[model samples]
Target: MTVASPLRFPDTASAPTMTKRGWWLVVMNILLPGSAQVLAGNRKLGRVGIVATLVLWLLAILTLLTYLIWPSTVYTLFTQTFSLLVVQILLVAYAALWVVLTLDTLRLVRLVKAAPNARAWIAAFSVVVLIGLTCTAGYASVVAGSARGALGDIFSSGPSQPPVDGHYNIMLLGGDAGPDREGLRPDSMSVVSIDAETGQAVTIGLPRDLNPVPFPTDSPLHSLYPDGYGYEDRCDVDVCQLNSIYTEVSLYKPELYPQAEKQHSDPGIESMRDALEGATGLKIQYYVLIDMQGFADLIDSLGGVDVTVSEKLPIGGDENLNGVIDWIEPGKQHLNGYYAQWYARSRHGTSDYDRMARQRQLQDAILKQVNPVNVVSKFQGIADAGTQVVKTDIPQSMLGYFVDLGMKTRKLPVKQLELVPPTIDPANPDYSQIHQLVQEALAPATPTPTSSK
Candidate 1:
């Protein structure tokens, strides 16, 4: 035994770094993945680690930014087509970073074990821990739960009343999402108007491809342009697409200008107003475009909403348009996001006018679900879950007023009018002429004042 002990030796090479500076560097790396090295004067190595962290961080930021600014077409892929998987992958990355930071902290404690100058490293780690705690507390206290709350009630202001007679008109459009499509086009265009004096709501939807809006006056657009009238603008009447009429409003009505110029068929609001007013005989006040994505998110927030099916929805498609088969069972049912979206966008059945009818029904459903009693109980939950999903002409401040208006609709009846080739029953349909009949259906009826005589 004595002879064997003579050959035994200490394996110092395998032990912790007991030197003062070595331990300090270890602590720095533990606290910040290399901050201790910089503190101990290893400038190059510390800088490299920091640069690596910055690059990874910047990459993460870029990923989030792309998700936001992407074209509506691409955004649909992320939200619907590839939604859950993309979210899972991002979450994994965040988790991995958290795990690495945790391991690094334990490694640093082990590396500087029993070192005399370990005190300095320990103090440094303590300071770093304090900073982290401070940041977490700040976010929890002020940033996370309290932003936008200071603005007062969330739905305090909204479409207080559905448009009544003598009010503005709003148009809403929804797009069907698919691998073949990227951007949003107004799928459900509704002209929601409210009377300035006696708030009333009136809504109507126009098919995306409905065009060739005819005008009473027949002249080239070039001649009508007061700003730059010339022969350049030449279209006999508004023989252009109905959607394009929004673009050509200035040409026809040189007196007015449209707001909110957007890239793809922004369809100037004024022309939309003109088209509706010309067709309906009611002066349009305003137009609102509610995208499909926003509609989906809002529906989802309600944790599924209740809607009544007025007719059997027949969903089928052909080469000319986006389509769907009948989805709902044709009675009152609770619908989730996917189902709600389909209910709103289903175009397969009989006519586009029918699809428009579904849109109004869904709107009614939403207003009913968020009534005062429901809003208080379900509003916050839905809002927290789906705030990112909605964009609307009604500002956040105005939402509460709508809540008030929605309560009124509980007693008020909803009216739907279909305007198209079949305004005349198909059996008696006259191909030769029914324009006046169709026009008469869409025109707002003159309200007669009661005479007590």
Candidate 2:
């Protein structure tokens, strides 16, 4: 037999080898854009991709470090309008760059050279990764845009106010502007005193029927109602209640609060804040007015709230007009927007005081439910509902600070004090006593000393 020359292999890779290499290039591109080009095809494009990838990595690392060291700085960056715009722009740019690099990577892979079976697998994987990454970046960009718009609509552009004393006292008013009612009237009122550093909170619930609503000495209303909000001759329950301050000022005495508009606030809201300051003895820095009718939408956006019901409550009915349409039974219950609104505002058999307590319960439950996962998933819904139903004088600049505080506040138990019967009758409230009680409730807890063994 003639000795044949040793079989010689081709210098170029076989179909199977090329297929494996193609997969490697695609994976490298996914992990680090432009890397595949540097390894195989276009060194220039690859260098640019590598540099961009490194810069993004550096930024991500720095952000992580900053969050660990000075978290508020990160919060401030995200909340600020200019910074948010920059972030949105960067996200869009990066998303585009990723797509470009991915396309270029496929060109470098030369998929046609690979085996038929391997070609399909490679193409499928590249498409999946491309779609997955781009979609994620796109979604994040949308979220940033939504947050920016919502913050602009919901919060004021006014200058940020410092914490009063060691805490921030924010007046929360739940207004009902039903078709039957004349104008927007606050049915629920409370002042939340939040510790500036620790985020501990004390909610002071004021009954809507509280008579003779006092005003600070500096307030214009002080001159009008020197002996409190009611008429001089008679303490009429109909005319003078804590909740009436809003509509009363808005409709009749708009001129009393000329500076209110300049400060990005309404005359009615300023008047209500002034009254709250006088009642609680806490300097109110901001006010949040929530439309009670639209309040259900807000609760629904949060995917519902969890609360323990003390007793059975009717959904919709008045003592005189209608019979009970629905009932929310007692025990730990998960309430949707419709039921949650009724849980807080239903007044058929329950007193205003009962409603006040329920409102506080809902508030606490909502705060607790606002965890990171829930917020991220339902952020758009929440933001949409918030803009429609909520109004506030809390400046946009301070939102980041409050966001951080809210996170801390959710972890701690809230201390509550409702100015109702037994504590102090709302019909005939003693101003001095109310002030004393507020101070006592807001006071820091005293730590007990431990004896060494």
> TM-score per candidate, in order?
0.46, 0.94
Best by TM-score: 2
After TM-score superposition, the amount by which residue 40's alpha carbon in candidate 2 deviates from its true location, in angstroms, is 1.9
Q: Give lDDT per model, in order.
A: 0.47, 0.86
Q: What's model 2's TM-score?
A: 0.94
Can you tell me which runs of candidate 1 are displaced by over 4 Å?
1-168, 175-183, 195-200, 205-209, 214-240, 244-271, 309-327, 384-403, 424-453
Candidate 2 error regions (>4 Å): 1-13, 231-238, 320-323
Residue-wise C-alpha lDDT for candidate 2, range 1-453, written one tens digit per residue: 221111112113477767767888899998889878777767788898889889989989999999998888888788877787888888888889889999988876778878888998998899999999889888788878988999888888998888888999999999898999888999899999999999999999998878878889999999888888874533323477888888888888889999988787889999899999988888999999999999999989999999999988886667763777889999999999999998988877778899899999999999988887887788889889999899998998897789889888999999999998988987788888999999999889999999999
**Candidate 2 lDDT for residue 396:** 86
Residue pairs clashing in model 2 are none
Q: How many Å off is the CA of 304 in candidate 2?
A: 0.9
- For 15-114, candidate 1 gives per-residue lDDT tens digits of 3433333444444554455454344334465566556556657866876786466433333332231343444444444334434443443344444343
Model 2, residue 232: distance off in Å is 4.1
